[model samples]
Target chain A: MELFTPDSGLVIWMFISFAILFIILAVFAWPAIMKGIAERANFIDKGVEYAQEAKSQLDGAREEARGIIDEARRQQADILRDADKMKTRIVEEARVAAQTEASKVMDQAKESISQAQKEAEKNLRNEVSAFALEIAQKVVRNQLKDEKSQKELVETLMGDMK
Target chain B: MHQRLFRYMVVIMACMILPVFALRGEDLAGNSAAAHEEDKPIDVKEIIFEHLGDGYGWEVPFNHHKRIPLPVVVKGSDGKWHVFSSGKITDHQDYTEDGVTFRLAKEGEHKNKIVEVDALGNETRVTDMSVTKNVCAIFLTMVVIMGLCFWLKSWYKRNGYKVPRRGLGAFEALIEFVYNGVIKSTLKDKAEKFAPYLLTVFMFIFVLNIMGLMVVFPGGANVTGNIAVTLVLAIFTFCFTNFFGTKHYWKEIFWPDVPLWLKFPIPIMQLIEIFGMFTKPAALTVRLFANMMGGHMIVIVLTLLIFIFASFGPIVIGATSVVSVVFSVFMLLVDVLVSFIQAYVFTMLSTIFIALAQESGHEEKHEKKEDAGGGAKEAAAVTTL
Candidate 1:
């Protein structure tokens, strides 16, 4: 019991010493310690927030890059399709031009052949008429001489025919 | 290979620490043995009590004496202060001068009391405000703690808000553990405000407790184990809680939210609540004091067992010494654990009391809205209990 019993001097001293220690610590030590801890906590929290921001930004950049790649692929397919269409159009146009040129040449040859045939037919008709005329002239020359000599005889034959 | 690595670490740590522990025993035994005269049988109980209780000097057992006498300051009946060395008192004898007598009365209930004798031979008592061993220990604790705080501050400045490095790194963990684990969890939003007080108290008590276990002249004084010291710490915590208590907190204690029938019969709840306030600090005082004292006593008693066995014969002494020393060391290790635990419990309880007395943040805001005075003045009122 005496051990627990308070000594007035020691109690007074205890109160003084303890209060002094508490006050001094409150002013000097505790605030500094608590501040250090609080500052560190805030710093760590900020660090974590910044890291999260960086991660989201990276993700956004990746998504945008992927979008760009997709656009490039689509453009490539469009260019290939346009090239195929141009190739087919050029081939069709060239085939059509060659067919028209050959038809024009064939029509000219047919016209020339028709003209030549007409000219040849006209000459042959003229020649045939000349030949027939020559043969008739010869026959008329001989028959006319005989016709004059035979006038007398014809008179007699005419009398008999009458 | 891993187990080998582990063994190597164990060996290295043991190599570093075991010698210090061995030297500690040698230092205490060597000094005590040299100090005591062979005329009287060594009384283990008395020796233990002497070590546990406060004395007029520090106990390195130097100069073939039990203590190195500290300064004695006493106010004499002549209404003036008389300051002298405690070495003035002769061994077990009355010392007289200037018609005033001072004697070291080491018998009866008031052992080591400073008794005064008048010129007419009438005996009286004088107020002793001397720095005794326990007081000296308290002073030492303060010095060590103050030094540590300064070091921590500079570390903060040098490191620039970084986690402490080197020796302070270990201390930072303890500070953080108490802040995050104890103060923050118990005190919540107001934790930062009260951290300085609680942190200081925790470190002071813990350092004092660990010093008690050191069992050497510079290291050994049961400051925290003393009832007076514990009471002072408890009183501080008590003042902190009540002084800063909110109106809501006081209301919960002074009046209860109960039915009228119960209220009229007797304000049992209020009475109990009042008692609870005093008991809270009282419990804190006793818990720390008893735990530290009990642990020290156990270690002493265990070590004393070897001496008791030595009375029979050398053979018995030899057999018991091994067991006794091993058990004593184990008890000391347990004491070391209890020291930290008691310090932690005291700080933890103090925070809980403060938290209970604090108003939740929303209630504080609502109260602020209802008040029709200067916000700062009202805030000050809330903190004045």
Candidate 2:
């Protein structure tokens, strides 16, 4: 028996079959495959959009929080300044009122001491005048007595002479 | 202009060299003009099978055996018909007006022979023809299958049916399976570009593999069981691998920057790795070829046993036929799985090669590693200081 040999026709047929197979696949199968891929791409794009939106929202919230904190700090400082001003005004007013009250008290004390001194000087002078009058009265009485004595002595001399 | 010129010169050289080699080869084979005369009447047989004569030849699968035949039909000057088989041309002597002349060369009587003829009407006989029925059947089956596929495709297209149904539908499903499962997965970025070629490879191998398993059925050809087809496929892959390879891929293969100590060994290892790249596809070819061939061989061997034990009578033939049928069916199921697997394997490997060729490197990962290394080095230097 002779050995078997493949015909060139078979090889040609193989090539033809291969070509036909490729055409059929390109037409029918490719679309579905691409569709699935496109879907996956769309999913990724959506995910990225969501992430971006979230980041923007987070930044907006942070800015809002910062603004609130700054406003609160300003309000607190304003309150402290007003309280300090009110405290200083009250102290000044009190100091002025106290000074006026003290000066009034001092003037009243001086007036009372001057009135007492004047009254004491008048009383002392009157007392001294009464005493002087009393002494003068006593002296006049003595002197009159002495003058009588002298008159007596003079009278005795006169008697002796008579 | 220089490249074109060079290419043209190469083509011219090839064209010139090919014919010279062919003529030299023919002369060395001791082919003679007189021997050509003896092969005249056999020319009629040439018309029966197109592409099966003259210097043209193809390898065929035949019951676990592959054969190459170069059937020549030569007409003698004396107006006689002679059939010169591949190796045997002198078996049938030239019946001349003078007497019968015998050409003696090589071994074998009427079986497996070759014929040689010299000048001055001398002839040499060499028997070396091993044409079997199985081989003819295989050849015929291949032709018929190809014709059927063409007719069906054309018919379907002409009818203007929007969607494929029946035969076309099944074929379309197979295409989708390969495209989605193998090509898309392996060649993620460029699967679309490579889909058509990869799909073609998948379907071609798949159909041939399925046919290989159809031996139990009448009129089946085991084409995939032949190694030549697989070798051709492998060569295509090898060419594609190198042709489509990117600079980065080649850099990794050739000038890999391994550590200084490992650099010498690495190149040697890379040489092996480069060799391995070719061997991978070669192994793919050989594996598919061997598996298909082995399965067919087993089936043929089983069937042959029935004939060998003919002395056991009709009962034995019946029992053996039943067993053979059962085993062939089992093998057929396994072959179906293998058909898809082999197709997938080929596509997968090809896609990986393409992916490797097109890879640009993971820049993000590389940058991250560099930053880490720099940070560590800075810390170490600070500590030293």
Candidate 3:
């Protein structure tokens, strides 16, 4: 029978103790715990979002870097092509200048050689005239010295002239 | 695998049988020597009830006569409050102070309880507000609950939302299990509003249940098994359910949507609904009380089988003790599980009751649509109840 009875003192104690526990927990304990859980959840969520953003930015940067490398390669190819064209043009111009220089040297040398040949020919003519004149004078003097012989030689020359 | 399995079975059988034979030899000599003292037959019912009931003090292990005294606070017949150690009045001797005499009642309705006696030898109950064994156990439970609560609160304070590790982690898991698995799931958005009471009751009953299993010192008091304690807890649910009940909830109870014939002719639905309101808490009280009380009774009964079989000779006594010990051990393990279950069930039913009381017209319509979409479990629970 006592087992079935609800004692007044115990019921009162149960109510009082339970009420105190509830008040203490609701006011002091549960809020802080729930807040902490929410905050940690928020922190982790933000961390994941930031990581995703960083990854996207890194991907974009990598793409831009690849583009820049390609552009630099294209520019390098253009510069090399321009350098090749310039080298060919310079070589062609040098060859033309060299040919023109060689022709000019040949023409000047030919003109100088013609002038030296004319001078040498003129000197030889003069020398040969002078030598002939000297020989004629010697021959006249010898003939006078031998008048007799000279007279007979002059008759022979006249007959020969007729 | 078969051989190993056979070996284990044989070993277990040997273990069970070995204890019987070993205890047989000792009990044979003991029983013969104590045969003349068999006039006092074992009162299995009394022993079981004593174990299931509360006391003025805690029973000492291996000794029934000795106990650890607790304070007994009672109002005397002289209209004065008296406080003394329960040990003073336990010896069937009267303790008198200020011309008022009190003794622990030995028989009748107030048997084994502190009472006052006049000169004519008429025993009357004074306002007994003693911190009896159950009350002491309640205090111990409170201390444990507070320690756990503050421990959890401190973790949240220091670490700010980090799940605790080790023992505290296990405590957190239980908290979350009750909160999420029962309270939040049933009450949904309203869980937080009633969460304090719900969580407190859950922890309180749970701690009391576990302490009841210890059978010594801080445990052994069947606080939850006492109907008085369960009645208080159930009353709390009743208050929460009704006080916080919605207008629609009250409407559904008194002026239900049954046909006019049912409402006017016999008021059948109204009568049933009103009866249901009281029965809900009653069921809660009896469910928890009976479960805990029964678990304790079964264990005590099993252990009593040894003494009950004493007249059958030493072999029977020894064999019964072995079987009784094994069964009681198994029952205790089961009771541990029952403790969790009963606690869980109490909290869950309370949550559902509160949730039902919180119901409005809008949710009913929403639930109807939900039922079409395969969400009829909550509805079914309500209907079944």
* Candidates ranked by DockQ: 1, 3, 2
DockQ-wise, the better of 1 and 2 is 1
lDDT of 2 by residue, B171-255 (tens): 6566567777777765666788777667657666776667556533332455565554566566666766778877776876776
Ranking by lDDT: 3, 1, 2
Ranking by TM-score: 1, 3, 2
Per-residue alpha-carbon lDDT of candidate 3 for residues B1-385, written as tens digits (9 for 90 to 100): 9999999988977876785676556666665644556536987877888898888888989887888999988899889999999889877789998889999998998888888999999999889888888888888888898888888888877886566899988888888888888877777788889888888899899999999999789899899999989998999999999999989889988888888988887888999999989998998898889899999999998888877887786678767877887899999999999999889888878887888788777646577335323323543353333
lDDT of each: 0.76, 0.56, 0.84
Note the B-chain TM-score for every model: 0.81, 0.58, 0.88
For model 3 chain B, the run of ten residues with the poorest summed lDDT: B371-380
DockQ for model 2 equals 0.04
Among the candidates, what TM-score does chain A have in each? 0.66, 0.53, 0.53
Which prediction has the highest TM-score against the true structure? 1
Tens-digit per-residue lDDT, A1-162, candidate 1: 456776555666677777777788889887887788788889999999999999999999999999999999999999999989988888888888777877877777777777788778878887887888888877766666776656866787899999
Q: Candidate 1: deviation at residue B273, Å?
A: 2.5
In the order shown, the candidates' DockQ scores are: 0.51, 0.04, 0.39
Residue B344 lDDT (model 1)? 83
The local distance difference test score of model 3 is 0.84
